[model samples]
Target chain A: MLDQLIYLFRRVFRNIRQSPVLCSAAVGTVAVALTILAFFSLIVINIQSLAAHWSEEIQIVAYLEREPSPARLKQWRDGIEAMPEVAAVRYVNQQEALRRFKSRLGSDSDLLEGFGAEILPASLEISLREQYRNRESAETVVGRLRQNPELAEFNYGQDWLERFEAFLELLRFGAVVLGFFLLFAALFIVANTIKLTLYARRDELEIMALVGATPWFIKVPFLLEGALQGALGAFLALGGSLALFQFFLRQGLVALLSVTGGDQIVFLDWQQQLLLIGTGILLGLVGSVLSLRKFVRI
Target chain B: MIHLYNVCKNYQKDAASALHNLNFKIAKGDFVYITGPSGAGKSTLLKLLYCAEKPSRGQILVNGKNITRMGSSHIPQLRRHTGIVFQDFKLLDNRTLFENVAFPLEVQGKKRFEISNKVYQALKHVGLHGKLQKYPLQLSGGEQQRVAIARALVVDPLILLADEPTGNLDLEVTLEIIELFKKANARGTTVLLATHDQEMIRRFPRRVIALENGQLVNDSAP
Candidate 1:
């Protein structure tokens, strides 16, 4: 068994070395396919992280009907702070609201000079707990807050959050569908590539069959070739992704993504990288097996 | 021993039969020749005996076991004890002569030293030991056939099947190949040589099974 294994390895290496062009074509096709996959994988990973981060930071601002007495303001703050969903609440007085509005007006502050503090409503800025940050949970919390008569209006940019969440869901679904299509496309490409290799050596394989070489003798070497091609392709893809990432970082374009505030896009972690490599190898093996089925009768 | 009872083969459905109702038997260590003109079912007969193509209509027995009923998975096991040399030489163009000859033993999972020693001996027996590293394309027609014979005999198989083993060689090379077959037969290997060269048959006669249009015409002893 060991002898056969050693010979099998020798034959696989020799077969690859004997036809470097065909072997390279197979590897190159796989590399190009996997690079596309890895690129999308990176985008999906970062977008998911960005979405989660933004969701955790969602805030709500509740405008007061009028400037409450100091005791009434304290009571309102205490009431909101006591809610299970409320993480923290900050009280913004009428003066502070007017100051903030003027600062935001910048060059137009002169237009706001005649405006009194009453023009800007005193509000309570509410931060929800992490668990209450999603669309459904935030809506539920807003429903609970609306029961208070002291609040004149509730503004949490809910429409923007809802749109963002919907868009994120669509993007995720699209990524999954696209990922599956790319995988099958890669499988087909690799299968045809391997079929070409099989055709090139059909006569040799026929001779092997004549000489009593088992089906496994013919199969193992080709399977190994597929796996090796997959690994090589994965390496090529990893290199391409890393090069692109470094280029983006060096150009200082990471901030333009607006996902992580200039933070560099993280490459696949060790486990993810391993999984990617394994997936590549599996694709190659499956492709080769499918291509080889028709030829390996004996 | 080998036996064929009413064996028949057709390459395609509704096509002419390649071999028709063939029946024969050869004892152990026998030397036999199957002869006829082109398309005489000479190659088809050898192919059937080696189990490359199934007999579409009857039974074949080797060593008293019904080979016609053998499963596809067990075909390799049957082939390991049987050697076949094709008319085209069938040597792998990409492999060295040594590798081609060593292939059979390697298939059996033989150790490196055993394969090396046995392949060397087989090549030496066929007078091609000095050209072990040469590829098939690099060798002459006679040399390639000799290498193929070495590959076949490397397994020390019980039955050696040759289909036009010397169809491409000149008279001198043909005699050399015949001598190699004679040597293998002397070693207790049953030899089946399929050919159309009557001159060689006249020169070295044995049991001749003649076929014409896929039917057995005559089975004669020299």
Candidate 2:
């Protein structure tokens, strides 16, 4: 077995050394496809993370009649926050609301002069926990708030909420679909390119078979070469994706789309980076296997 | 010893049989000739012996083991005990003569030193040991054939199967190769030479098997 291993290694090296062009062509196509996959995988991870954070920050506001009794407000607050899904609740008086609004606008006093501070009605601002941050959960809380006698009206950003829900669903669905196409493209590209290279050396393989080489003697080296190609291609893909991401950020490519801020355009974290490397390696190995399938005789 | 018991091989169209009920046997340490014209099933017979193609019916045995149902894995083992020299020479275009001759011993897991020694000895036996580093294309027709013979003999196989081993050689070179086959048989390696060289056969004949239209019509001692 040891001697066979040595001989197989020598044979693989000789083939590659003799046919450098063919080897590189196989390896190159695999790398290109893997890089595209790694890039999108990074996008999916960060989008998922940001979406989770968005759910936490999302909430609804329930405004009440002027100067509700402290006891009634307390009762309403307890009822709202006591629900199974509510995360937190806070009350803001109209005066406090007006003061906060004015502070935000900063000297745009003409619009406010026509209306008194009363225009800014106090409301109970309710925040949901991560689990209950979708439209149904928000609506459930609103329904409960409307039943309270002291509350005059309740409003949540319905358009924004629906859009958010749709966008999140779209990202997840798009990522999956994109991932499948990218993965297929990766495998197909690499497999065929490697096939072309292997086909060129069909004579060499036929000669090997004639010399009484056992099944393993022919398979192991090609498998090893495929593995090596995958590892190298995977590494190259990781680097390529990172470079592309940096370029995207510098060019502010996401700004042309619907996004919050540059801060939210998150880079790939540790988990994401690990996933990319794993993916790259997988593409590399799978591509080579597909290619070598027809090349190596049983 | 190799024995063909009514061996018959057939393909789709051209003939009902490439080799029809061919019965013969070549004993160990024997040198014999299979002399026939082209398309006379001489090549087909050699192909069957090496397990390259299966005999359509009847049993064929090598060293007392039947090869009609032998698995591909066993073909190499059977082949390890036998060597074949093709008319094309079948040397790797990029490999040197040394690598070509050393291939069989290497396949047998012989150590580097043993392989080098065996290959050198085989090459010397053919008187072309000095051209060890040259490629196949760099050598003349006769030299390339010698290299192939050296490769076949390096493992010291029990049987030597030569298919037109000297089809392209001139009179002088053909005599040299015939001498090589005789010497190999003298060393207890049975040789089966397939050829149409009537002049060579008349000069050095022990036994001859003549085939015409897939029938073995003659096997007479000279």
Candidate 3:
């Protein structure tokens, strides 16, 4: 078994060496296909991270009708915080609200100089838990909070949040569809490339079969060739994706898309990177199998 | 031993049979010749023996096993113990003589050292051991045929089938190639050589099985 493996490896390398142009073309085709996939995946990954970041910062503000007694404030805070959907609840007094607004205005703080603390309503800032940060969950928590007579209005940017949620769903659906299409296309191109390679070496394969080579013996080398091409292509694709990602970052394209911050725009994580390469390998193997199914009988 | 019982082969549904119903048997260690004109099923007969082409009817038994109905997966197993040489040499032109000879043994999954040793011996047996690094195209026609013979005999197969192996060679080279087959036959490998070269057949006397129009016309064996 060990000898067979050794011989198989030798044959695979020898094949690659003898037909460097064809092998390179195969590898190049795989790399191009996978690079497109990796680039799209990087976009999806960054967008997902940005969405999670925005979701993490989702806060629902409940404006109090009148200044609550200290006891009542404590009750409201504790009650909201006790809810499973709520991560935390904090009471912001009129003075603190004005101070936050002034700070946010930065160099334009003078524009709010005439405004008094009473102009700003005292409110409860309700931050939802990670799982409850979506539009539906936030609305559910809002509906429950509306039962309190002391709370006059709730502001969680409902219109835009709903739109953002819809847009995210659409984006997610598009990504899935596009990802699968791209994968299928990649597999097809790889299969054809390997098929061409197979045709080029059909004579050699026939000779191998004639020499009493078992089906596995003849098929394994080509399969390994595909796998090696896949692996190399994956590496090339990742490198290309990384370079493209860095280019996008330098061009501020990712930063422009980022809601949290420019720095939050990042490449695929190691796990996702590994998954992309694994997909490449799988594509190559499947492609080889597809071509071999028709071309090789022995 | 090989046995054929009413074997027939047709290339297509409507085409005439390449080989008609025929029966014969050869004991182990027997060297036989399949002599026939072109389209006389000489190649087809050899092909059937190696399980390349399935028989349309009847049974073929190699060493007491019915190979006529053998599964495609088991064909390689039968072929491992059978070596076949072709008129075209079928050598990998890009590969060296050593690599060509080592191919069958490699298919057998022999160890690297064993492959190297056996390849050397096979090439040496063919009188081309000194040119292990030479490619098939680099060698003369006779030399390339010798490489093919070395590759065939390298596995030390129980049955050796040569189909017009010397069809491209001159008389002198054909005789040299015949001598190599004779040596292999002497070593107890059953040899089935397909040819129509009457001069070569006359020079090296062997049991001849003659065919015409896909039918066996004569068998010199008693």
Candidate 4:
């Protein structure tokens, strides 16, 4: 068994070395496919991380009725905090809320200030546990908070956040679709390159068949050749991905996205890089084996 | 030894049989020629001998083993005991003459040293020892044929089946290839060559088998 492997390996290496042009073409095809996967993975990671961060920071703000007693306000805060779904609770007094609201109004604060600081009611700022961060889950918590006597009004951008989540879901779905197409393109590219190599050796294949060479005797070298091509392509793709990310990051796309703070837009980390390369190798192997299946008979 | 018991091989639904009730026996060490025109069952007979196709009817036995009933996995094992050559010289263009000849031994899982030595010896037998590093395209038609012969004979197989082995060779090289087959036969190998070259076969009168439209027309010791 060891001897058979040795023979297969030697011939495989020799064939790859003999045709530098064909070998490089196969590798290039694999690398291009791998680069596509890396691009999608990068997008997915960023989208997922950003969504998680936003879910953590979002809170439902419940406003108190005018002239509510301090005892009632304290009781309301305690009740919200005691709920298992509520991770934390803060009471923003009417004056503080009004002051902050004016600052947000920028130059148009004079019209609101004339109405006095008491115009804005106190709000119960509620932060829910991370598990209740989904659109449906967050809405459920809002329903529970609305049944309070002290609360006059409530404001939570549930509609806007739901729309944003839907948009992000669409982006993720698009990325997945794009990813499959890229994988297919990469597979065909690699297979075609390997087919060209096989075509060049068609005569030899016949000779091997006539001489009763086992199917594996003929297939092992091509498969190894494909595997090597995949690995080489992976390396090339890694380089291409790095260069592309650097280019975009240099153009300040990462910083421009900081308005959506906590999204932390960036390229793939080391583990993700490894995954990209691994995927490339798998694609190359499948393409090569599939391409050669018809040509070799055991 | 080999035995064909009323074996008939057909290709398609409408096509006629390539071999019709072919009853024959080839004892060990027989050197015979399957002489026929194109589309006359010559290639099909060789294909069956190497287990490439099963008989549509009847059966065959090689060394008392029923090859027609044997599974696909056993085909390679049967082929290990046989060697084959083709008229177009099925030599791998990407492989060097040495690599091509060394292929059979490698298939046997022989050690590299053993393969190299046997391949060198086979090349020497075919008078291609000096051109081991040359690719098939770089060599002439005769040289390529010689490389194919070396590859077939390298495994020291018991049976050697040739499909129009000299159809494309010149007169001078044709005799050289015939001599190699004769020499291999003298070493106890059963040689069966398919050829339309009557003049060449006539010169080396031995056992001759004729096929016409899939029927065995004649079998006689020339």
Candidate 5:
């Protein structure tokens, strides 16, 4: 069996060497299709990470109508912490809120020379659990907070964040559909490419069959051909995508995205990359098998 | 050993049968000739013996196995023990002569050293050992046919079936091809040669099973 496999491998390489044009056409098609898929997949992965980072930073500020005593503030903190949706609550006194504002203002801090700690509001900053970070759940939590008589004003950055999430969801859906189409295109192109190869060599295959060659003996070489094409295509796609990704990084896209306080863009992780390669190999094998169905019968 | 009983083969249900009900038997190591004119079902008979085409009716026993009812998976096993040479020489144009002859032994999954040794021996037997690296088109029609014969014989099959192997060769080349068959038969491989060349048939006398109009008309030994 090992000897037969060696012969099959040699035949596969011989076929490729004889028909370089067809093999390149096959590899190019797969590379283009897989590159498209990898591009969108990477986008989806990073966008999802960005979305989660923004959601985790979500918090609501409940300004108090009057400054409570330290013991009363502790009681309010304990009450908010008991709520299931509230992950944690911090009592930000007027002094602390003023200091946080000054830090945010950075170099413009001198412009606030006349401002006093009394001018800042003492508020309860509420952080919601992951499950309650969405717009509807946050609104529900805020509605109940508004019922508190001691609260003067409630503020949370929900409007723009909700819209951003909706846009991301739409983008994700489009990426998924596009990914499906790319995979289909890859399979179709590989199948036809291999079908042409099979047609060109039908005489040889017939002769092999005539000489008592088993179906596997005839099939293994073609299968190997397809797999090699697919893998090469996938690597080509990876190379192209990696180059494009590097281009984006060099152009300061990572800095641009990081300006909003989220981490820089990430490429596909090792596991996802492995999955993509596996998908490439599977597409080649399937395409070759589909093309061989009719010819093998002859 | 081979046996056929009431075997029928028809391509289409409404068309005339390619082979009508036929019955015959050839013992082990028997060299026989299936002689017929064009469209006499000579090729079809050879195909049936190798499990290429199933009989429309009746049964065929090749070495005591019911080939007519053999499963598709078992067909390869049946063929592994049989070798076939075609009229067109069916040589792979892109492969070297050595690769062409080495194909069958490779199919058997023999070791590389064994396959190399056997292929060399078979090519030597056909007197074309010096042209191992040559392609099919690079050689003459005679040389190509010799390569095909070497390919068939390299497997050392129990049964050798040839379908008008020398139909395109001249008298000199035709006799040379027959000499290879004579040598293979001498080594105890049962041979079945299909041809309409009466001159060649007269020169190399054997058991001749003559068919005409898809029916057996004679079986003679001279």
Candidate 6:
């Protein structure tokens, strides 16, 4: 068995050496395809991460019609906090709300000089649990909260959140569609490239068959060649993606996103990286199988 | 130890048969020549024995194994026991002589040390062990054919089938190649050489089986 493996390896490497140009072209095609996939995946991953971060910060604020008694305030807080989706509920008085507004103004607090605590309404801030932070759950909580008669108005950036959620859904759909198309295109191109290589070596293959080599013996080297190309191409694509990621980091795109409340941009995690490499290898194997099915006999 | 029973082969539907109702039997250790005109189905008969092409009708038995309806997967096993040499020399020009001769042994999944020993012995048998590293393209037509024969015989096949193996060589080289086949036959291998060279046949006579238009016209054995 070991001897056979050694022979097969020798044959695989020899084939690659004999047709370096064609093999390189095949590898390059895989690399280009995988690199494009990596870029799109990076975009989707970061966007989803940013969306999660924003969702965590979402809170429902119900403005009070008038100042309530201390007992009434406690009653409202206890009721809201008892809800399954509500993580916590805090009551902010008129004075405290004005103070928060001034703090948000930073150096421009003078713009609120003429305003007083009397103009601002006290509110109950309702923060949802982690699992309930999505648009649907938030809306469900809001619908239940609207039954309270003491609440005059509610604001949770509903319009912005809804649009953001819609955009995210569309982005996810686009990613899947685009990913399928890219993978199919890569498989087709790689199959054709390997087919060309097979044709170039058809004479050798015929000789191998003539010498009583089994079908597996003739096929295994080509399969190994395809797998090698896939692995090499995947690594090249990862390197290219890393280089592009570093280039963007150097250009301060990540810093700019951070300024807009986005989390730090991340490349594919280890699992995702493995998935890319695995896909590349699978692409090569399938391509070789497709070409071999029609080109080789016995 | 080969037998053909009313075997018939047609390459295409509604086309003339390549071989028709052919019946013959050759015992072990026989060196026979299949001689006929260009389209006399000499190659087709050899192809059938090696399981290269399935017969459209009838049966063939090599070493008591019926191979007429052999599956594609089993063809390789049949071929491993039967060595075939073609007219084109069928050598990988990019590979050296050692690699060429080692191919059959390697296909058999022999051990590394065993492959090396057998490849050297096979090359030595053909008097080309010293040129093991030479590429086929660098060698003369006769030398390349010798390398092919070495590759074929390296497996120690039970049967050696040669299809016009020396058609491209001169008289001297042709005789040299014929001698190699004779040597192989002397070592207990059943040799079936297909050719139309009457001079070579007359010079080194054997059991000649003549075919004309896909039918056995003569079998020169009482």
Best by lDDT: 6
What would the per-residue lDDT of candidate 3 be over residues B54-144, giving only the tens digit for each residue? 9999899999999988888888889889989999999988888998888888787788899999999999998998999999898899999
Candidate 6 or 4, higher DockQ: 6
Candidate 5 wrongly placed segments (more than 4 Å)? A1-8, A63-72, A84-123, A129-140, A143-155, A248-263
Q: Against the true structure, candidate 5 has what lDDT?
A: 0.87
lDDT of 1 by residue, B3-88 (tens): 99999999999999999999999999999999999999999888887888888999999988888899988889889999898889
Q: After superposition, how far is residue A4 of candidate 4 from its true place, in Å?
A: 3.6
Candidate 2 per-residue C-alpha lDDT over A1-298 given as tens digits, one digit per residue, 9 for 90 to 100: 7976788789878878877887777677667877777667667666676667666777888887776789977877788889987888899998889878878888785567767778878888988887888789888888877777668887777788788778878988998899899878877876776677678777666656666666666666776776667667777777887798888742353564356666667667777667666765676567667766676652
What are the per-model DockQ values?
0.75, 0.46, 0.61, 0.59, 0.48, 0.70
Q: Residue-wise lDDT of candidate 3 within A80-118, one digit each (tens)?
A: 888999988888999999999999999999999777899
* Model 4 residue A62 distance off true place after TM-score fit, in angstroms: 0.4
Ranking by DockQ: 1, 6, 3, 4, 5, 2
Q: Is candidate 1 or 2 superior in lDDT?
A: 1
Residue-wise lDDT of candidate 6 within A97-124, one digit each (tens)? Answer: 9999999999999999988998899998
Error of 6 at A136 (Å): 2.1
Writing each residue's lDDT as its tens digit, candidate 5 over B1-222 gives: 999999999989999988998899998888899999999999999989988799999999999999998888888788888889888999988889999999888777788899889999999999999999999999999889999999999988999999999999999999999999999999999999999999998898999999998899999988
In candidate 4, position B84 carries an lDDT of 89
Model 4 misses residue A211 by how many Å?
2.6
Cα RMSD to the true fold for all candidates: 2.3, 3.2, 3.0, 2.5, 3.8, 2.5
Q: Model 4: what TM-score? A: 0.92
TM-score of chain A taken by itself, candidate 2:
0.84
Q: State every prediction's TM-score relative to the real structure.
A: 0.93, 0.87, 0.90, 0.92, 0.87, 0.93
For residues A1-298, what per-residue lDDT tens digits would candidate 5 score against the true structure? 5755677788899989988998898888888888889887877777677788777788888999879988988887887888889999988888998999999999999888998989988998899998888777778888888788898988788778778888898988998888888899889988998899899889878877777777887898899899999888888888888887777642454564564433457777789877877888888899999999978862
lDDT score for residue B129 of model 2: 87
Ordered list by TM-score, greatest first: 1, 6, 4, 3, 2, 5
